[model samples]
Target: MERRSNKADKFKYLQPVDRAAIALMLVLIVLIGLLIWNGDRTAPRVRNFSWQNQQVGAEDTSFTLNFNRPMDHASVEANLQIDPLLPGKFSWAGRRMAYTLTAPVFYGTNYKVQLQGAKDKSKTESGKENEKLIDPFYGQFSTRDRAFVYIGVEPQEKGRLILYNVTQQKKTVLTPADMAVNDFKIYPEGRKILFSAADWLSQKPGVFEQQLYTVTTGINPLSPGKPETKPEAAGKINLVLDSKNFQNMKFDLSPDGQAIIVQRVNRNKPGEFGLWVIKPGAPPQPLENQPGGDFLITADSGAVAVAQGQGIAILPMTPKAKPLDFLAQYAKVFSFSKDGASAAMLKFNTNYTRSLFLVTNQGVQKELFKTTGSILDAQFDPRSDTLYCLITRLQKGEQDQDQEQPLLATVDLKKAKMTPILALPNQRDIQMSLSQDGLALLFDQLVTEKKLPKTGALTTNDGQAIVNSLLWLLPITPPTEGSKTQQQQPQQLPLPGFRPSWLP
Candidate 1:
């Protein structure tokens, strides 16, 4: 009787405590379940952004956004806004979203991107209670300044490569007094420049003693509008190819800065002329055994286009490699698109006229327009749908004298439409360069005289005695309705230089 009573008392106390613990556990479980089910009501946030206070370039065509939670693609795109109205396409990959620009961004510009009023994936899919909006996101970015380098025509800084900042009034001399810079090409990154130079004090001809070199531009495109902070690496020159055994004629730096294509003629044997390629830290290698005319390296740096026997041969960059493609109708390639998919080429027809053709790598050749005068140069816009050509047309002036007038024209590749942007009367042998953003054009107007017999004076690239040279900046704008000419006027820069080229 005593044992039964003790066991009953213990069971009675344990049963009450066990019931209380079970009830508490059930309450906790229910609370956790409710929290888990309502988690979709939490606000969505942008975890990371690609262009947050970053400096971008033409190569940076796309940006991405990583979200903390899955987002509704349609709502996010509809809520996103970019300043200056950059046109692009959007793509989604799980929690990440990307925006790819259809055209290149403008240089020396400040941009802002904003996003708001977007919903989470769960709230968007299901009509659930307590729906929440995503947190507002904002981003900022800037581009590099508009800058160029040219040969100084002034007597004090003659034969020197000078860098002039168009955005900021800053100038830096890039060559020493002993070296005379001839021609130069900027690297794609704008960090270095490849140029040809000669000893200024040597009694021999500058052409015979020409050597190849690279100089640091000391430009930091990342920090736009601040030339004062970017002052390092100026006037730092390195020898690339020496002219001890051969004479270097025409040379081109690859767009990727990996290879250099140069035309050379052997010193000992005048008949031996060919093309040579120099890689990074490697010796010069012969590309072909014969000579070519007006050669240029492709944008991809995989091949070179050479004008050969009334045709253009696209030869691979390797040694002794055969031609990759050949076009028998075009005489020369003026410039290539940024993607390396299209090119602006020149064709010399038998009817005493030249035609500008838009040639694609897919073997599509469309003639943009035909001109009866000479085609000086051509450049493709960033969109690859417009071509800017510098050509000449015959005009009668002053007692019916035939004059070659230079005209700056833009051709729409899709519509085959030609519009005359600017006409330079009494201008001959002019040089032009297009800006990276396709917003402006740089050209030089030179006043020249006949060269003296044997004077140690300065002369332009075309052997003209340069009296004065002016640099003009023309803003590229569309023609107004019912008007045939652009209303924007050309602004003359306060720099005295010739053969001006924008830093890439």
Candidate 2:
């Protein structure tokens, strides 16, 4: 009875303040529960991020990412940043997002990405706001090692194949001083190099007695104070094809390193020049009805493109693949896209002018540029859309033609615009080399006999200019390049060399 009376008195005499306090406590609990629910809805998390393909040679075209909650499309686009700052577009399907690189990513570079200004767009059951700001997300990836090889152009460094480190700014000559290397190509592994060299053992060789040979590009040419213990043994040079039977003059190694295509000139018949495909330890097979000059094997190794009598033709690796006629009117197929889908070609427009066109795989040709300049060389950018060329425009003179300046320009296929990247005067014997990554280019300037310096770094006392190649590098996509408000010139490497090529 007493406990009942106390309980009854506690409820009976309870002030309005007590009742209000109980109501406030209930409301607080409800508010706290609502806050937790809102947090769960607002929190956005990255579920997965990955590359779609692993066979990307130079640069990947696109990538994908997924999140736990729907994202604000505008916010994601505004906040996303790709290191090396590649231009790209973003698309979203539900919680997953895809990014397509507008300009293909540069090869041999590390890319870091961050998504800072993203927000979640989730729904709440109570019809309340479920918006939440996400934490910054980060990821990083690399394309491949940036590597290149160059032919020594100076007198002392003549005919030497040198492996250069683009990042480290160091160099190591890969060939021996005894042999003279004429033309070379790096295998896909970047460790082995296939080259044609003068055969010293030949009985009575021609002017350029070149034979097929390969050497290890990974060997360290220098040792600690002492000479390489066994220089010959350490040098992994193997005789693939000897020059005894045929004059193996020019050659190109396939990207897969499975076979080599050599433009052979028969020693017996002075006029007989043929194309042969040779494999290690296997007899060389001749391609019938194929007359070759400046030939290149396709990226897939399924066909070969040769500059024949009239035009360039794509002859299949097997006869049944059928021949594809390309550039029927052009004299040469200067360069092919990385995937062999497009080509850069040059045709004579008039006696003094040339027309450069970008030809697609489907026989579609687009006139990139037509100018009165002599197109010394033209190449397709790795992306298969842009084109770069080294053009020398004649300012005056009928025969010699006092040139105004050598112009290095890039043609944007999308906009049909020509932008000059460089302008230099009096650069002779210019040859351009683009890295497999398509991030850099190399060329050499000719040092003529009369203009030779007294120091004679690459000159003879007789005032004859035989060896004059000054190597220069122009970085199109440096991994850590800063903003460019003005034009930048290519840096000249102190080492005198030329005919540079990037390794895949």
Candidate 3:
């Protein structure tokens, strides 16, 4: 009886151990099932996404992207990139991500905003193993094609003006190298480009000046392996009526390519520049008796426009004839109409509060537009009835800042009314030029922050600022009345005959 009782006790003790192991197994199964269920429920999936503002090419622009769920900031930043490597910053609000980029973006260049390898944050109950997520996301978008124009600039290094064919699918350098070109004019035929380059003779170190050179499309084919050719001089480009100490420079060309206007700078005077004209292949004739500055010539007609101290004068093409007595006081001519019947002038007081006026032959100086900011640059369309001007507004409370301007505005003139077309990014030293078809604009966008003058004490004393300028082309639609709808179309042809100096 004692042996049997001992065996029974051992069996009872083993029974408790068996039950405890069974209970532990049950708990493990439950935990595994819960993990499986949560993993299936919380699998990452992408939600719908869109650009913050669909309107592309707007100045000082931003883009927003939506996501299915809150994203890990590190993951998103690791995946996001804007081509051309624009200076930008990224921020997130709720399920949306915003990116703000700096300008001057090449107007028609295809820009890709890419988001790759982004992952969502794991749920709290996803367990410790799910702490780090591996799911990724991707998105891509291109910028709009409108508001792009071609801009050209003359670099001092080689005296070569870089002409960027903004709309061309392939990059083509319109102007060749080894030329000493400064200011240029585009021919009305759109087949030729003209500019004043130091004559081959003047290219030598001791030479004082140069003459105008013409590069014809038919003459200079820009094909590979072809020998580069020099631009032929159309006629004599020299000072005809200036003090021997003054330097003569070509200013503009007539539309028919028959006449050229020249500006003579007086060496002794601080602000003295004189105007003259000569028929191509003929002798030069004086247009103004006294010092004048900033002159423009009509392409269609041989009419000459000159700006004196707050005054403007129009001279007929007749050689050695007195200028027509249509003096505009307190006004400066910016551009002339296609028919040379009207002029676009900026009227300003001593303080420089400016108003744009359309002056007609009928003695009508109508105030087409007024602005609190100063007009930096202006150009007339091929039709001459429309004017495009760049205006700048000073930023508030930032008056002491070296670069305090906040905005650049484009003003349009039509039917005696002035309208604001678009405002550009903050830039300085702005310049505007329109293509012959009026579909493109070439302008300079000042890269202000990057344009810090690299001048030493001696350089500053020499009156030279070390600033870099970038040229850009903006594509635009002609302003049509009552049509708020405008579309940017890619340019099909090279920008030819766009600059006034290139006009034949």
Candidate 4:
């Protein structure tokens, strides 16, 4: 039998170059093993922070922290700290930790985050704990400035969209001169404004001929204080829906800024009133449901709440879709929370009294309070536990509609307490808006005149006649324990405008 060559005898015939190459490969494997072992024993560090030096928006509800090594979830969560007290939940995936906010952060606030004593999840080969502490990390972020948009009532800027930067003390006109803006809604990003306008120079400049258009706000959401640079000029105008066959009525811009919900009536058939959606790159389409009164596009931008007969109907935006849910108790839906969890609504009682209710998605209807006067509008604070309402209270011994005084009130949802903030006597058809940070309130007070202006009669969004309008800003301060409720006063903004609204 032939003698079999042993493994050592076969390798003895190898060249010197090949033997050296094998030795180099063995050394590389040992080096790699040593490197991995050292890496596991080293201290963990934050490799990336999602909101590092970034400016966030309302839609930015969560941030992420990436680590260089696997980390102990409990230790990381316990050591994570955010300044100014932002309530949120922590989640982990491998070495990444995510913090999701329970609610939108207050606008115009600078937030700081720090993590010092987080431990890693590494272990020794013998199954012994060998966790390493994470390196100290600090990060910061900021929100956009406090800003608002209004319809300029001044003679030179009449019927124009005016953007006022409350933080910077700057004002800029966003619309052209020849077009008369009817009504407008700003996009959630604050980069564009959707409005209805008509040719003011034309003799037939009527509301029936109004057309939907969008104009550039030039307010960059990323770098808020800096103007947006683009190929098109700032304040560029683009026509969206025209009033060729249907007249555009009250309209709302979707929170995502992808679509517009506008009430329109057929030009030929005045009785045919319905809601139409004008989406970008698509023609206007009508919802298959019946025409309803005073509608609002929901926060999710997927449905709409319309005031139908004796109740409010929540209908999906899709054509031919059935109603998502019909709230037979609520007669009017005013506003929804940022997360779309709660809505401020109105219920009409048989005794002619209207009750404001905080309707939640969790099948809970909380009755805030009842008022004999009408509830013009209500807005939920970013915190969702506070509500600001613009309501009318019947004056003593007066039942006339004009005798109703507008009162700005705040309701603490948790404590079930209602506080009157401001009393606007002789202010009719007044409009109020709450800031994103829940720190300021804006409302317009119109000054009536015996005679109309020489240019023409200026009217509000509600079609009320007015000579001039005054914008007022009221700062909202949290009530402290043992502190008296002092009457808060609003400061006039020196802006001659109506329908003042805070930018998103």
List the candidates' TM-scores in order.
Answer: 0.87, 0.69, 0.52, 0.88
Candidate number achieving the greatest lDDT relative to the actual structure: 1
Q: With candidate 4 superimposed using the best TM-score fit, by how many Å does residue 93's alpha carbon deviate from the native?
A: 2.7
Q: Give the candidate order by descending TM-score.
A: 4, 1, 2, 3
TM-score of predicted structure 3: 0.52
Model 1, 89: alpha-carbon shift in Å? Answer: 1.5
lDDT of 4: 0.81
The candidate 2 region of ten consecutive residues with least summed lDDT is 219-228
Give one digit per residue, the lDDT tens place, for model 2 in 145-212: 56678767755566677887765676777787766676688776465788877633431223546677
Tens digits of per-residue lDDT for model 1 on 1-504? 999999988767787779799889999999889877655456899999887777677878899999988888889999999997788999999999999998778877799989899877764334653445789998888877778888777777777899987777789999886677778989875888899988765413344577999999887555332232455577899999999999998899898899999999999999899899999978999996346799999989989999988789999988889888888878889999988999889999989899998899898999899988788898988855778889989889799988788998888899878777789746777889998877788898888777551334445656666677788888876333455335578899888877889876
Cα displacement (angstroms), candidate 3, residue 222, comes to 19
Give each prediction's root-mean-square deviation over alpha carbons. Answer: 4.9, 11.3, 22.6, 3.8
Angstrom error of the Cα, residue 96, model 1: value is 1.1
Candidate that scores best on TM-score: 4
The residue pairs in collision within model 4 are: none
Clashes of each: 0, 0, 23, 0
lDDT of all predictions:
0.82, 0.69, 0.54, 0.81
